[model samples]
Target: MPNSDYSARHLSVLEGLDAVRKRPGMYIGSTDSRGLMHCLWEIIDNSVDEALAGHGNQIDIVLHADTSVEVSDRARGIPVDIEPKTGLSGVEVVFTKLHAGGKFGSGSYAASGGLHGVGASVVNALSQRLDVQVDRDGKTYAMSFRRGEPGVFDDATGISPSNPFKPFEDASVLREVGKVAKGVSGTRVRYWSDPQIFIKDAVFASEELFSRARQTAFLVPGLAIGIEDRRGQEIAKHDFKYDGGIAEFVEYLAKDAALTATWKLSGSGDFNETVPVLDESGNMVSREVSRKCDVDIAVRWGTGYDTEVKSFVNIIATPKGGTHIAGFEQSVLKVLRSQVEANARKLKAGNDKVEKEDALAGLTAVVTVRLAEPQFEGQTKEILGTPAVKNIVANVVSKALLEKFNSPKRDDKSQAALLLEKVVAEMKSRISARTHKETQRRKNALESSSLPTKLVDCRTQETAGSELFIVEGDSALGTAKLARDSEFQALLPIRGKILNVQKASVSDMLSNTECASIIQVLGAGSGRSFDLDVARYGKVILMSDADVDGAHIRTLLLTLFFRYMRPLVEAGRVFAAVPPLHRVEVINAGSKANEVIYTYSQAELEELLSKLAKAGKKYKEPIQRYKGLGEMDADQLAETTMDRSRRTLRRVRVEDAAAAEAMFELLMGNDVAPRRDFIIDSADGFERERIDA
Candidate 1:
C-alpha cells in the first residue's frame, strides 16, 4: 500500500527562518497572546542585557495603534560594520541568522539572559514586519524586513557612498536615517506580530507589559524603564526606576504586612573548578577554571501566613526554582534551626528546633545571583541547573545570616529577637498540630474500611494499576458502574458541588462528607500527615459532565486536592478524563449501512461531516450533543471515556506553584471582586458557541 520510490529525494530541509515559522511553538511557547508577549520579551531582554552589561540605563517601550510594539534603549547600538564571517552587516546578520549575536562566546557581555542568541532572529521569524534603527558614531542607520525577509525602502533616496555599510541586492544597506547628536548611542526595534501565526485578534495587554517593565527596573538598579500605550484613545504612561533593587522589591511586597524584621545581604566570590582543555598534542588535559559569582538577598518576615520567595539567575525569574533556590532554602533553614536552639537555651525553653515550613512561614525574600555562563534547564529558563552555584549561594547566605544573627545589636528587644520569637512560636504550634494529626490519622486508618456507602470499590488489590474516577452525579455514577472494569476501576459519586477548599480551613474541609469520602478513598493522609506512599490509586481521575456546572464541580474538587493532598498533584498522579460531547450517526442507502461517529468538539464534528461529504456519504440531521455524562449509555461511555486503549486523559501538573496558588485563591476564595475581574479578563477571548449552557 506504500510507494516504493520513497528515498533520499523525499527528505526535506527547512532553511533560514522557515523552520521557525513551521514550528513556532517550539521557539515562543504558543501562538497565543502569551507568545506575542514573548516576542516583546525577546526585544526587551536585549535591552536589559545591555543594562546588565553596564552600558544602558534608560529603556522606553511603546504600544502602537496597529498592535505593534517598539522598544528603544540607550545602550551601545548594534554594530553596523560588516561581519567578517558572514560578509553581512552586523544588524543584518543578527536579525537573519539564528544564534548570531554577541552573547555567545563573546567577551562583549560577561553575563546575559539571551545566551542562545536566538531571541532577535526568532522574533523576526514570527513577526509580519520589523524595523530596526541604530544610533552609533554620530549617524542613524535603519533597516526593514517583511515576513523575516530583508526589504528595501520604497523610496531609495539619499543613497550615498558616505554610509559606512554596503548595500545588498536591491536592498540599500544600512541606509542612513538621520544624523544623531554627538556621543548619543542606542538601538530601537519595532515589530508587528503576523496575524496568521497567532490566535485571532491577538493584542498585547498593557497591564502585563507594565508589570514586566516594573519588575525589570526593580531587578536592575538605577535603570529607568518607561512604558507608553498609544493603542487606547488616552495614551497611558508609566515609569519605573529603583535605586534599592531587590531590597525595594521586598519592601514593596511586604508593604501591607506587619513586618517584624527586614534586612539585606550581599556577597561576591570566585571558585576554581576543573575543566578539560585541548593541549598541543591534540589530547585533553585537566585545568583549573575560575568562576566568579555574586549573590544578593533581601528578606522581610511578617505576621501573615503567606510565603513569597522569588529566585532569579542573572535577572531571569526562576519561578519553578532549581539548585539556587534549594541552596537558599537549605541555608536559611540551617541558620534558623541553629538560632532557635541558641535562643531556647538562653531562655531555658523547651529543646525543639524550628521546621522548614515554620522558618519560611510569613517570609518574603528575593534571591538574586549573577554569574558568568549560567546553565539553565530550558529555553524559557524558569530554572537554573548549575551545580556549583548552589554551594556558592549556600556558603554566602550562611555566613551573612550568621553574622547578622550574632551581631551585638541582636539583643532581646531587637528586631532579631522578635523574628526568632515568632519562628519559635510557629514551630511550637506546628509540632502540636502534627501530634494531633498523627493521632487522628491512626484512628482514621482503623476506620478506613468504612468508605462512603456510595463508593463502588474495585476488585483489584494492586494499588499501582488501580484508578479511581470521581464522577459528578449519581446518574453518571450509575453508568460508570455498569461500564467500568470491576478489576481496576473504582467510582465515587458526589452530589452537586462540594465545598471550595480555597476558602475553607483544614478542619472545616475534613468535616464535609463529600471531601472526607474522597480523601479516605485515596489512602494518602490529608494535609500535613499526607504521604504519597499510601496513595491507593495510580490515577485519581476527575470525570464530570462537559458543561459549565461540571466545570465548577471539577474546580471545587481540584481546590480540595490542591489544599489538602497537594503532594498527589505534585507527584503527577491527578488526571482529568475528557468525554465526548457530540455523536454523529452516518447513514447510507442500504439497511445495514448505519455508522456512528463520536466527536469531542464542534470543530471535530464539522471536520468529520466534511470528510463524509467528500466521500459522497450522507449523514442524518440533528447531531446529538451530550450535555452531561448521564446522557451517554454505558457502552458508549466505556468506549469513549473509560477504555484504557482509546480514552483521552489529561495529566494535571503544577508548573508554577505561586501562580497556581494565587489563581486558586482568586477563583475559589471568598473574595468576589478578584473573581469578577478574572472572569471579565478571561471572557475577552472566550467563544459563546463553546458553552453548553
Candidate 2:
C-alpha cells in the first residue's frame, strides 16, 4: 500500500549556510527578539575575546535609526591574506564557512568565549546585509555579504540593505578600499537583522545591551566600552570602564546595609582533556591536553537576608549557573560550618549545626572561571557541563577563603569573627523556631492542648476558611465574641501595645509573654522555620480603634509580623479592618422611620451632608462620632466590621520589603537620631485637628 524502497536518490544534503537557514533554532535558539540579541552577542563576544587576550582595550557600539547595529574595536584585525586550501581571504572564510575560524586550538588564542567556530558564520547567515572593514598592514580592506554570500553592493547614494547587490559567480573579491597610517590596526562590522528570519515585532532591547556591555567591562578590567544610540529624537551615549572588576560589580548589586568588606579570591588549577587535533598530514587525531582553569571571586555579606550570586565562564554569563556555582556554594558552606563548629563556645552556639541557607544569607558574590573550550550544555550556553570544573573550583574556593579567614591582618580577623557570629546567630534562631513549631504541633491534638486560655478559637479544624482577628482590648473582645461567627472566626485579645520586635533581639522577643502567646496561638513557627502549609488560619486581620494610640498598637503588631512571620504578609493574607467613624441619622417626614448613614472619612461625611442639604432633607444636628469599638453595640459592630458581605476591609501588602524595612527601622528602631530628624522634617505636613487632645 506504500512505497517501501528507500535508496540513495532520496538522500539530500544541505551545503554551506543552507542548513543554518533551514534550522535556525539549532544555531541561534529562536526566531524572536532573544535570538536576534544572541546574534548580536556573537559578534560582540568575538571582539571581547580579542580584548580578553590582551589585544585591545577599547570597543565602540552604535545603534542606528535604520535598525542596524555596528561594532568597532581597536584590535588585531581578521587576516586579509589568502588561505592555501580555500584560496579565500581569512575574513571571508570566517564569515562564510561554518565550523571555520581561528579559535579551534590554532594557538592563536589561549582562552576565549567562542567555541565550535560557528558564532561568526551563524550571525552572518542570519543577517540580511553585513559590511566588514579591516585595517591591517597599513592598508584598509573591505568586504560585503548578502545572507552569507560574498558579493558587492552598488550603493552610489547611501548604504542600505535594499540597495542593488551582485554575488560573485566564479570568485569573490576583497577590495583594498584605502590606506591607513602605520601601526594602525582594527576591525569594524555593521549588520542588519533579516526580517525573513525574525518575527516582525522583534527589536533590540536597549537596557539589555547596556547591561551586557557594563557586565563585560566589569569582567575585563581596563577594557572600555562606548555605546551610542540614534534610535530616538535625542541621541544617548554611555561609556563603561571598571578598574576594580567584579569587586565593583558586587558593590553595585548589594542593596542593604553592609556587614563586611568586599573580599577577593583568586586561584588556578590544571586538568587533562581529550580533544581532536589536526595532524601535520591534515588529518584529525585524538590527543590529550592539559588545560588550566582560573577561578576569580568577589564576595560580601549584607545586614539583610538576601543572596545575589552571579557566575560566568570565560567572561560569558552563565545565569543558570553550572559546576562552578555548585563548587562555590559547597565550599562556602563547608568552610563556614567548620569555623562555626570550632568556635561554638565563644559564639554560644550550643550544638546547633549551620545550614547552606545560613551560609548564603545576606551574601552577594560574583564567581567566574576561565578555561579553553569548556563544555557547554547547549547552543545558548546557559550552563557548563564540564564535570571536572566542579572539584577544581571547589578546591580553589576552599583554600582561598580559609586563608582569608585565618589571615594575620587585624581587619581580616575582626570581619571573620563577626561573620562567624552572625552565622551562628542565624543557626540558633532556626533551631529555636523549629523547637517552637514542634512543641506547638504536639499541643494541637484534641486530647491534650496547650493553647492560651484567653484565645477564643473557631470550632472548625480546617485552615482554609478560618480567620484570626487580633482585637485591641478586652472591651472590644467582648463585643467581637458576640458579633463573630463562632464556626470560622477566631479572636485573640491583647491588653495594650505589644513589643516592637524589629528593635528587639530574638531571645527578647521569644521571651515576652504577649509575643510568645501570639506565636503559640498561631500554631506556626516564627522566622526561617515557619511552615506556611501548617498555619492555623487563612487570614490575619488587625482590628483596633480609630485613634493615634490604635495606630501605634497596629504598627507594633506589624513589626512583629514582619520580623518573624513574613510569609503570611507576602502571601496577601493580612488585612486591616475598616470601621466607620461617624453615624448620621436622617429624620424622615410624616412619622416614617429615620434612615441612618455611616461614613469612614471626613471627605465622605462632607459629601453626604452636602447631598442631603441639596435634597432639602433634615438630619440630626450632632452626628455620633465613634471614638472606639467599645462604644458600638454588638449588632452595629457586626454590620460595620465583622460581616464579610457588608464590612470594608483593607488588605495589607508589602510591595517593596527594603523600603518597608527602612521605614520600620526609622520609626521603631533604637536609633533615635534618625527618627528625630524624620519627625522634624515631617513637621511641616502635620495637621492640628487630626489629633484628639
Candidate 3:
C-alpha cells in the first residue's frame, strides 16, 4: 500500500484532457439522458450566444446517421484572431481551457444562454470528435479534433470544393457559404458524442427539443426556427414565434382555462431581479460595489387549480428553483396579507381564510433572473443558490406590488385590483375548505381504519407484489377469498353499488362505506391522507366479470382510483384482470379432455368460427361467454384470473395526461353543460362496442 497522505502525490494533477474523459459527469452533469443532450446543447447554446449578440437569427440542427448531430448557425463565427496574452487563437482557448469564452468579457454577449464559459470546453473534452468552422473577414477557417488531436491540418481549404470533408456523405445537410453576403457571419459546429463518455443514448427526443425550441421562440420575438429528425421526419414543424413575447407566452399557458380578465396588464406573475452575489468572506469583498440591478416583472392571475411558477437564473429554467422562488413566495405572502388587512373584508372563515397554498392558488407566475456570475448547485443547473438574488427579488416584488395594489387607477387599475381581490377571496375559500375538509377527514380516519366487515382482509401486511382481487358481488368474492394467496393476496368484495368520488363531495366520499373500507385496508387512508408508501399491495388488480355490468363496475373503480388515489395509477400499481370471454375445449375426435382447452377474445371467437368454416370441422364448438364472475367457480377463478402465475393483468397507463385530465373533468366535474357537450361530440365518432352493452 502507498504511504498515507503523501505531500508529493498531492502536488501532481492529471495534465491535458484526461481529467474530463475520466469524470465526464463532473463537467456535463451526468452520463444520463440529460447530460447526453447537454453535449449537443453546449454547441447549440454557442449559436444561441451569437443570436444574443445580434449576429444572426437562422440556426439549423441536423441529427446524423450515427446518432451524432451537426449544428450550423448563421450567427457571427467565433473570433479566430490570436490573443495578445496567449499565442494560441481564441478558438483554441475556448475548446481546451475550462472557463475561457467571449461571455467572460463585456463585448462577447450581453443576454446569452447556457451556464457560462464552461459549456463548450466541457463538451469538446467529452466528445470523441469535434469539428469547428469559423468564417472571419474575407477568409474561412476550419479545424477538426479527435479528442484533442495534437497535430494541426495546415492550409485547410474550406473555400475549395475538392476537399473530402467539404462534400459530406449526406449532401443535403451542408449548404455552400456565400462569400459576398454582408451583415451575416457565424460559427458552425459539427460534432459526434463519444459513447465512451456518455452512457445514455445520444439520440435526441423531438418532444424535449420541442419544449426548449418553443420556450426560446417565445423569448426571442419573431425568430423562426425549422426542425427535422434523423430519418428526415418533418412532422410537428411549427414556428413558436410570439409577437407580444412573454406576454403572448402567458396567454398560451392560460389558453386551456378561463381567464377572468383580458389584456395582460404585464408579464403574468414573473418577478425577477439581478442582484450582486455577496462574498464578503472572500478577497473580492473589498472591491467597489455599485452594480445597479433590475428585476423584470410580469404577473397574471388566472382562475385555475394549481399555481404554476417558472423561474430562471439567466435564460435557463431553475426547475429546482433557488432563493429566487423562496423570495418571490415570501414577498407575495407579505404583500397580499398586508393588503388583505388594510382594504379587504374579514370574511366568514377564520383559520381557513389565509393559508400558504391558498395565497398562491390560481396564480400562474414566472420569475427569471440574470446575474454576472451565477452560482449553480450542480452542472445540470436545476437550481440557483446565490443568497442575495432571492432577498433582492423578494424585496423588489414586495415593494412594487405594494405600490400597485395600494395605488388604484381609473380604467385598468380596477381590473388589476379586482384580480388581486379575487386572489384573496379564493385563498380564503381554499383555506377554510382545506381546514374544514382536514378536520372531517381526521375524524373519519380515526373512526374507521381497518378493512370493512364485508371485505375478506388477508392475514399479512408485508404485501408488496401482492394482489388485491376486487371481485364483483359476494358470490365471486367468496370464491376468490377461498382461492387467494392469503400471504400476499387480499379479497375485497364490493356490494351492489359504490359511490363515485368524482361526482361526490369529500364528505359524501368519506361517507361511502365501501370506498372508506378500501382506504383503510390499503393502509393509505384516502383523500388528503393517502400516502403511496402505505399501499398494502404493489399490484391492485380489479377482477370483474366479462359482462357489461362488470365493465361498468371496472370503470367506476378505475374512476375512483384515478380521482382519489392517482399516485397508485401513476406508480403503475393499478391493473385490470383480463378474464377469458370464451372457454372452449375440443374433447372429441382428435383432442384429449383438458389438454385441448383454450381462451379467446370476442374478435378471436369470431375468427375461430370463420376458421372452423374454412377447415370443414362443422361440429359447432358452442362457446360460452361468461356473463358474470359467479359463473366461474373458485377453481376456475383461481386458475384463470386470480392465480399469481397465470393471471393476465393489464397495467393501466396514461399516455396523454392533459387529454386524460380533460376527459376525466368532462365526465366527472360539476359542470353538466361541458359533460353533455362532450357526450354529444364524442357520440358521433364513438365506437359502441367499446362501452358496456
Highest lDDT against the true fold, candidate: 2
Listed in order, each prediction's TM-score against the native is 0.61, 0.85, 0.69
lDDT of 2 by residue, 1-693 (tens): 011221222112115676788789998899998998889888888899899988889999999999999999989999999988878899988898887776787656677785357988888888889999999999999999877777899999899998997776657789999999998999999999989899999898898999999999999999999999999999999999999899999988775556789999889999999999889888999999999999999999866555889999989899999999999999999999999889888988877789997888779999999988888999888998888899998998899889989999999999999788778766776776777677665233455677899999888878898899999999999999999999899999998999887666556687898898888878788866678877888999999998889889988998888877889999998899988889899999998999989888777888999999999999997998999988898988999999989998888899999788778878987768999999999989998656741
lDDT of 1 by residue, 443-562 (tens): 222355545678898877677888999999989998999899998999999999998767654445666889878877775666555778767788899999998899899889998888
**Model 2 C-alpha RMSD to native:** 5.4
Better of 1 and 2 by lDDT: 2
Candidate 1 segments whose C-alpha is farther than 4 A from its true place: 1-14, 153-172, 255-260, 272-288, 346-351, 410-413, 440-693
> How much lDDT does each candidate structure score?
0.80, 0.86, 0.63
| Tens digits of per-residue lDDT for model 3, 294-342 | 4554566654434667776656777888888888888888877666655
Lowest-sum lDDT 10-residue window in model 2? 1-10
Steric clash pairs (candidate 1): none
lDDT of 3 at 684: 87
Instruction: Give the residue spans of candidate 2 off by over 4 A.
Output: 1-14, 114-116, 137-140, 176-184, 232-238, 437-455, 470-479, 492-530, 542-570, 623-634, 651-693
lDDT of 2 at 274: 95
